[model samples]
Target: MAWWKLHKRDKPGGPAAGGAVLASAAIITRDQVRSVVGRRQEWQAQGWDFYRTVPELKSGIRWAANGLSRARLYVGRIDPDGSSAPVPVDAQGGDMSPAMVANLLAPLEDLAGGQLGQSEMLRRLSVHLDIPGESYLVGFDDPASGERRWLVCSPSEVTSTGSGGTIRVQLPDSQSARIELSIDDCTLIRLWRPDDEYGYLPDSPLQGLQDPLRELQGLTAHVLATVDSRLKGAGIGLMSDDVTPASPQQSDGPNPIHSDPVTASLIDAASASLKNRDSAAALVPLLLRVPGSVEDKFKWFDFAAQLDEHLLPLRESATKRLAIGLDTPPEALTGMADVNHWTGWLVSDTGITMHIEPKLGLICDALTTQYFRAAWEALGIPDPENWACWYDTSDLKQRPNRAPEAAEAHARGAISDAAYLRELGFSSEDMPDEEEQRRRLLIQLATTNAQLAPAALEALGVQLPDVGQAIATDAVRAPVEISRAEPAIEAPPRNEPPALPIAASAVLDDGWRMACLDLAARRALARAGNWLLSRSGRSRRGELGHVPVHEVHMHVSPDQADLAQMLDGAYRDFHAATPGETDLHAAVDLYVRRLLLTGIAHERGLLAGHLAAAGCDRAAA
Candidate 1:
């Protein structure tokens, strides 16, 4: 049998012999679990080390780290109804006491591990979280204070039960003493990320990506190996034609036409000399004496080759594949030139929002459940279940490359000016104080009033107070008398109509206007119905007007009143959310477009119904 072929065969229709043999064997064992852990440890170490050398992996991990580094922690309460309320810090003069939330934040800011800062710790954890899809965060309680502190543990240091519900942690000590922890142990933080199936073991983001990553790695190694081999093996091969000695040398017979051995030795020496030459000339020439009358020929060969043109694109494809597997944008991974700056920002923001933040959120949730519950219980707080630990992700919620969007929103009254200012990069401290803001608002209001007063008086045909005379009494601050007398200003020509003043109550709320428009629409619908009924009568030929045998088109054309009513309805529906009255002509034009479409539909429906009835009547006849 061939090496690949099985030595034994089952029945033709039965399972494969090898598969049966494997199925009969035990799948899970203590050694197998340990071996799997060993493999994971190996992969983690290799993956981390590889990140430094691989640009794609480095970019992906750095992107995730930079995105998560912006996280701000906040202590908050999860209500019984699943709503959350932030428990404010007392340092900021919040209602809640500082002691309540400080316990959680303190340990987070100062983890038990090495001298790594909080940002550094998160960056490391984020890398492991993304690459491995799981990480173990071990907590150690203070011996005297009993406060909880955390240390990030390698996956290899932790072992799990068969069901994976319990974990055994090996302390990083000389003896490596181990401790068993239950599934709910607050000291153990297990981050399990499963894509489709739920299990204690999580699938890595690099799982499906390994093939492409390894391919890229292999291509890189091949390039390096080729370069190394080329540099080490680079040299020219020498070729010479065979020559025959004329005769043996007799010392005194004109060197007796050098013998073959003597000539060979001389040629070898000449070749070595040529190789050792270090002259400034571009080419070195060598002359060798031979024992034969035949001319000697020396040929030199070059060492070089044309590289494969397809390798660049193939390597790029592999990089893009790996990036896709990591949920990272190709432009981010490869610095793809085809992607514009705005597009790259959008793509990066999407990856951060949809993939990166959620992973960090999972870590936050685990920490919250473990630390917040314990801290609240230690503080004699009741129903600690309502409280959870969370990070502030408000900065990440902003739309990338859309700072102008905030300004537009402010202009539209969708957001406050303070929020707009913040979006524009002004910190809370940079904003004007409340007192200064109040003074600014007063000045703005006064200026607005001054600007509008002249327009209001002009509309009423009242002239402004003579500012020249008022300036004389400016020192006394006396009010100027209004001029009731009609000014010498000539009225508009008779051909030009005078503008009419609008009433104060001209502006109506949406609901009231919509109701009036609805009433008008209902009346129009009633009139249309009556008109359609009136058309169903005896024709001039004394036959049913709507009979199909007559073959007359039964189309309902809209009248001027009907069209006007529909325009009003469309106008009301379009501006249903408007805060006040709008320009009548503009509103009518906007509504007429929509009214024409709907009116056509309504007429078609009525005509179709009438035609169907007429067809049935004709068929009965």
Candidate 2:
């Protein structure tokens, strides 16, 4: 939905009173605002966590498209001041090495393919990775002054992409660069290659620029309102003049999976259904990831959405659900006295943003999966099928002498959630029921869930309605096939050796295809003899199977690292010097550069019989 249309708090100016049209998809929840307005409040209070509501789908268009279009960014001395001059993003004679530049461009490549821009784009800079206090410097060649200056990547852009993946941005080229980009799980850690014409080069800065915050130019109010806020609220303090607008050289090119007839039709149908709302632009991309990311971690991208999220809480019983990640620290839940209640939130560096609303139906299965895991472990439930019994509650609660109305919920032969009890099974009649006791029990029918959350609306004192429409309705009939997935079966070892993924030039039909196969063969060679026997091989392609141009790298160094670091820094300079890259395509290019530097692609070629084969021969010798 449009940022203006989403839930807005009543401010002195009114809902979106000062918001400009350029602020289209950008919207923060009242809770997020409450963070800036109420920072020191000490989430020390019970259930006082936070979450930044991300758009269901956001494109990484160049930052300039929005009100921040005029924003000027620069290298820094640090702080909110214009004390530093804008950095020069180019080197006169030194060329960054191609390999290092490839490392830098990995993440940018992903950005281009994914369709992110400006506020929309930067909002996700650190989505998958985090490297606080680290920075990348760019040397710009000032054509007019003939002076070179250096700019440091601000905290806003240097944030992380979770999963240790790259940022995916394209390298700076004079418009005609033929860079095709796509992401594959294996390629994530390898260096990417752009079209042959363009080459990588490296250069270092002679000096650094001043921090933009020091300039504060008419932004004292915003800065103070935002000083303590971390990366999340950083952009808020920025005036339209403060942000470094996205260069169009960045953006994810186009949807490749959307080309599939079934997938394409699904997106088209979904698009046709919601054509009336312009803000629903990202819906298509959100749906496409289910079929994309070969690695399930990529599925987290979908969790970064709003549509399915908003409706999740509503689909289940109002009873609270509790979730505890094995990795979460007890410190995170400091003041939360009641740990049994249902709690969900978006996790990130700034902090956790708790989701207060009920979830929709689509995500119910996912939630059940997460929480039921705890249940399965609690009871001696050997198999998942045994856990299936937990979802049905009728058996424990139903008994003789119960009024017809009492049995109405289960009378239809549905697998009612004996919502009445779980783990510690209990029945009304067995406990010598009384009307008053039953009334109290009626109010909290699902005793099993009591352990799951506060007893009532008044109990925890959460400000939601008590006697209202039932939050979750009766379970519906299954429309689609609901077959349970089989457990992963292990593959038995085989004695046969592996073969390279090869291409008959005629069968390949194109150089790109030939290139992909050649790369695959090279990969096989790299990993040959490293394994025992038979192995499976896979290939990744973008658009019509062409290698995209972009890179992403994650590392912290004083000035530079090795050959790769020098090159990544060089091309990052190239992107800053170039302009007009605020789109999904450019985001991919940027990722590409970083990916190359990180050496994610270069490693993919070492799977079987390729360059990584020496080890097997060594073992035999």
Candidate 3:
């Protein structure tokens, strides 16, 4: 039954109402449907034109395309845990190297046997997908080599035949003919989905950006016109009081030259000369004058400033809107004026993460499902479904260097060796296995012991053994015998006078103790400040608040021992100045604690200043 008839039959009044409703229903003609589709196609064509002609839009698209093209492609296996791993090439469980994988997929490097390498192909695909909302790739086996070869087809030149998964592809043959191929041989990657009754075809990102793009184009044209007008000296306008020019007979006023035909002709010539100047005459001045009354007789007006006040802001606003629509940072399309190095890096990272990665993901998934899988099957690779093509975007991301932080964490035992190695950009395969790490550790211990053994034996006054005999003996037994035989002769002590007590000795000043404590405090403060700066530098603007203050205090904790040693030396020198019963060690410990508290407080203030400068407080709110 027709959809309209079914709708009518569901009415409240049964058959009679059904017949009436059917008669009153409005039918959409095939021409109307075609007209809608035609309009959509025309809109898509306009989008392509914008991508080609509009500088801002073109710049944004190319930025995304180039970023995606920088990614390295690979074929790997999908593990059971949803993570991907390198594909093993042999029964011995040896993974295929990148070069070997590239060799296997060498046919895809040049698509359709043309100069289109993988990078160029990916760039074109990204451009097409973003601009027209869809792209097509057709795969075929090379007749000569029986290896897979693919061609990137224009979306406009490919269409679904709506029968048995067949598609009509226009080939660039001598006749410029069209050919029909199964959908299995082609891949269609698209962006947005269709909501109307037209079909399942996806819509371009430009669909919602048409208004902004058109406005940007208009503003650009206006700017160009304004610039051209300025270059032609159109901003300068002349005004005069006379409504009509007087003839030579009426030349009785103070401005008699205005009535003189020769003078008027000379003035016109000078005006024309001043309009456009050649490069050679650009710096030369040409003056025009009329032999008339001064001041109010003639006036000049400049409109360049007025034009800028109205037009430039609109142009900038339109540009920002278009960039937002494209999911790209404005700094990427526009020049990076007023941007710092850190801000520039942030802009690049955001462009890749938010704008380029999604498009790359779509393209990769489509190729893997429709192109790489089939090729694998044709080559009789076992379990083809277990493997897929992927892209590595590590080269595109502007990740900050956190090696210092990683090292600190590793030393603190906060992270595993593997995690630390990964943070330093080492892949899992580049890291050593447990057994290898243990062997290396043992070798390092043995080398250190060997280097120190001679000095240690001399200090102990023990005779050294022959190297060969030592090696022949049991390693454990040799160490035990040497340790048991170690015994160093001691020298007799020289007699000296006993030190005086505090009250019985000459009075010493507090200046020495204060100086030592101050020096130690300054060193501690410097250490704390350096640590704070390093932490702030590594954190993002929003992450400043998340910096662990306690960790920083712990980092400075070692300086407390240095301060205690300084205090102890100062106490020894000044003990004679104090009372006999004074507990100097207790006093020293108290002063050290006070200095530590003050230093920590100073660091906290510095961190707060950094947080303020980064606007983290506002961000948190």
Q: Against the true structure, whose TM-score is highest?
A: 3
Q: What tens-digit string does per-residue lDDT give for candidate 3 at 1-621?
A: 311123223234646655332211111122222322212467778998888778888888888788877876666666668754444332114465655555346424434443335777778787877777666565544446756445566667666565655666676564577676543333333323243555456566787899999898887887777665444333322334433332234346776545455456434433443575443222322223344454655654443333667677788788888877785666776567777866666777877877787777777676666555544544445676777666777677766677999999999999988778767877657877887786666554433343333444444454544642243222212222221123111112224322222322222223454344334434444454344445454444245454443224323333432333232233343444443412222233232333343322322223222223322232112
Candidate 1 vs. true structure, TM-score: 0.50
Q: What tens digits encode model 2's per-residue C-alpha lDDT throughout 524-544?
A: 222221121112133322221
Best by lDDT: 3
Estimate the lDDT of model 1: 0.49
Q: What total of clashing residue pairs does each candidate reach?
A: 0, 192, 0
User: Could you estimate the TM-score for every candidate?
Assistant: 0.50, 0.13, 0.51
After TM-score superposition, the amount by which residue 227's alpha carbon in candidate 1 deviates from its true location, in angstroms, is 1.2
| RMSD each, Å | 23.6, 43.4, 20.7
lDDT of 1 by residue, 1-621 (tens): 311112123323447433332110111233344444423645556666566677888788778777776666655655556554454343335655656456435444444432344455566577767666666666544345655445556576777755554556676555566666543333555555655665656666776666787888888987776554333222332334444332333455554434465454444434444454342111332233334343344444334233568878989899878777785555567676666755666666777767677877777677666554544444445676666656665565545545788978998999976688777866556778877786666654433332233344454454434642232223112112111132111124435532222321232223454344334334434444444445555453244344332112123333433333333333344345442322321222322222222232222222222222322111111
Alpha carbon lDDT at 73, candidate 1: 60
Off by over 4 Å in 1: 1-49, 77-117, 141-149, 156-186, 195-198, 237-298, 303-306, 394-405, 408-413, 427-433, 436-476, 479-621
